[model samples]
Target: MIAYYVHHQGSGHVHRASSIAAQARTPVVGLSGRPRPAGWTGDWVDLPDDSDGVDASSRDVTAGGTLHWVPRRHAGLAERMRRVSETVARASLVVVDVSVEVALLARLHGVPVVVVAQPGERTDRPHRTAYDLAERILAPWPVRPAGGWPDGWTAKTVHLGALSRFDAHPAPAAGDPCRVLVLWGRGGIDVGPDRIAAAAAATPGHRWVVAGPHPGPGAWPANLTWLGWVDDVWAELSAAGVVVTHAGQNALAEVAAARRPAVVVPQRRPFGEQDATAAALARAGIAEPTGSWPEPAAWPALLARAAQRGGTGWDAWSTGTGAARAAALLDGLAA
Candidate 1:
């Protein structure tokens, strides 16, 4: 059996976990604060939220801010660690996607750990410590050129380009009036309603659709329609002539799968993760990236440029078999 630790922050971690776990030959067990997703057949162990009983005055959340997060005197934290300890004792390999504390715990318990690598400035002590201790580092994107990763850390790393649930979905035909899908994740975009409305008004010919949590307040223009959060992300991407989204790993990979051009507006993330991801996409000619949100007046040119690209260079990022590739790696480790 293999143990998989899914971070309960955004849906991305769990989504990625589910994709890879489905391809695993061995029975996979999941540990997370989030509930087991619909299609997962694996045994699940629900972990309590560590942030639930945090007390700054009484308990130490971090070991002097050196470790990522370890709430001192936290019952939930203690229980979660205990569960992990118990699981690792029975499992042959542990996959973390990801938490530094969990990675350390698994390693200390004498279990080999595969740590998921996120795109960002991960030169910090906590990140470095986890990377150093990991038996393998799984990068979701294609192997980036030199200078992006930490020194000597890429040797044990396996670059599995953009794992997405919809990689096998056929590219959707372009819709009339040029449908534009705007995706927002849990982190939410920095773009405001006024700007979105202004952009909609400026491009009256195209239909603008906003999806995901927190679409912002106020009424939208007639051309702009808010879908809020929808279960079918691929449907929206398929119908879109172009997509405007944050530079999140899952979102980017999904866009690549749909074979649609995108205007990437990176939201603020730890260590400028989104910024780094957007830069890579732009360099690869996969997407048009604006360091920040583009002005409403600049939308016309930006969208036009994105549409012209037509998501031609995205196959390198969306291999369509990344899940199988990652699963094969786990199978090898388990063996």
Candidate 2:
């Protein structure tokens, strides 16, 4: 059995976990705090049911083979550690995305773990330390030639490329001009409607779609279409010619996987992780950086440049042959 432990802090980890669970032939179980994506076969814990409101603050729920919760802040360290230990005990193998506690628990259980991340320069230190405890560390993008993990760690660290959720989904219908899809996370602080409206107005020839968990009312322009969280963001992703989005690790990879070039605007919040994500993509020559948000007039030319640059087919490194090989390695450990 494969146990997927997701922190639910970002949609990227859940997206990554969904891809892994979908590919696993074994009985896959998921533990997450975020709302589970549709069509995922595994039993998931703490996933919200349809009756649940999007704004509900209920921090914890469990169903299927997963456990989901927002950890209490006042809990003692020992008690929190005990709870994590219990969760780890139930799984033979633990697969985590960028969770430090997950690594600690997996180590206690002697359960091999696969740590998935696209590390930026800032978190490199903690990430490396976490990697020390992991059985294998999976990098979701192509590896740079220098200043990476040491050779002793090389045997365990694998650049599995970017994981794309659209690989199996049917494509969405083509829209007028080229549809530009802009997506943000649950927080409105990072990406606001102003950028979306401006982008739509600046690129008069193109249609713009905004997606995320619905942030309450704002003045939406006629050119911008507000598409709240849909079951098939991937469908929209497939149909988009230009994706203007935040520097979400999974989002960037998904854009690359679709073979479309994108203009990425890094988020300034939560410690500038988006900037790190954008930096790597920019360095890779796969993405054009627009800081937090770019001006609408700037997008037309950037979109044109992205169209010319095209996608680098990074999906093969994560979900394709790379995942297959990683699975084999994991199975060997499970054996």
Candidate 3:
């Protein structure tokens, strides 16, 4: 059995794990602080929330920069690792989607660990230690960046391309010529609703639809409709002429799967994670990336440029077989 540890900070980790689990021939039990998602394939273990009622940042969470999130006095942290250690005893391999501490725990137990590589500037001690310990590093992007990682780790990694739940879903034929879609994750976005409204106003010829919750309560612009947390977002996503979204890997992968060109405004994230992704997508010419949203007046040209780029190149990022490939790797390891 493969024990998958999913980080609870963002939905990306869980979404990626679920996609791979769906295709896994081997039993893949999920371990997370969050509850089991609606269609999880195998047993789901609820790991203790380490940050419950605690100021994680204010305390000595990092062990003086040698590691990440090992709070000194947190009972929840202790219990979380204890449960993970129990799982390690029964698992053939552990897939860390990611947490350095959990990787270390599994490695200490002599279980082979495959780490899900995150896109960011991960050149720190804890990250290096985790990478060194992993039997394989699975990168979810098509191309590993040019520099930073040593040769050994670069060779050890398997580039899985972008994995998304939507990869298997066929993108519907293009819908309205004047549709622009926005996707906001439950993980808070740095971009404001007013700014989105401004962009919508700037492009009155295009109708803007937001598929996630409105960040704040407010009346929307004439052309912009806030469809808060729609049950089926693929409809809006697949039909849009252009998708305006953040640079989170899952969001990007979903957009890629739908074959929709995107105007990517990378939100602020730790270690400049989104920045790295935005740069890669921009270089690939599949998405138009900006450090931040441009003025309202600039939205028209940006949207036009993004739509003109089309989404043919998106398959370069999401090959529609990433999940299957990852599952095959896990199955092989289990065997």
Question: What lDDT does the true structure give each of the candidates?
Answer: 0.86, 0.64, 0.88
Clashes of each: 0, 7, 0
lDDT per residue for candidate 3 within 30-126, as digits (tens), equals: 9999889879969998998788777766887898998888888889989898999988889999999989999999999999999998888888899
**Candidate 3 clashes between residue pairs 3 or more apart in a chain or in different chains:** none
Worst 10 residues of 1 by lDDT: 168-177
> After superposition, which runs of candidate 3 have C-alpha atoms over 4 Å from their true positions?
56-58, 215-217
RMSD of each: 1.7, 6.6, 1.3
Query: 1 or 3: which has the higher lDDT?
Result: 3
**RMSD of model 2, in Å?**
6.6
RMSD (CA, Å), candidate 1 to true, equals 1.7
User: What ranking emerges by TM-score with the best candidate at the front?
Assistant: 3, 1, 2
Task: For model 3, give the RMSD to the true fold.
Answer: 1.3
Q: Which lDDT tens digits does candidate 1 get at residues 41-96?
A: 99999998788857765666668877878878778888989998999889899999
TM-score of candidate 3 against the unseen true structure = 0.97
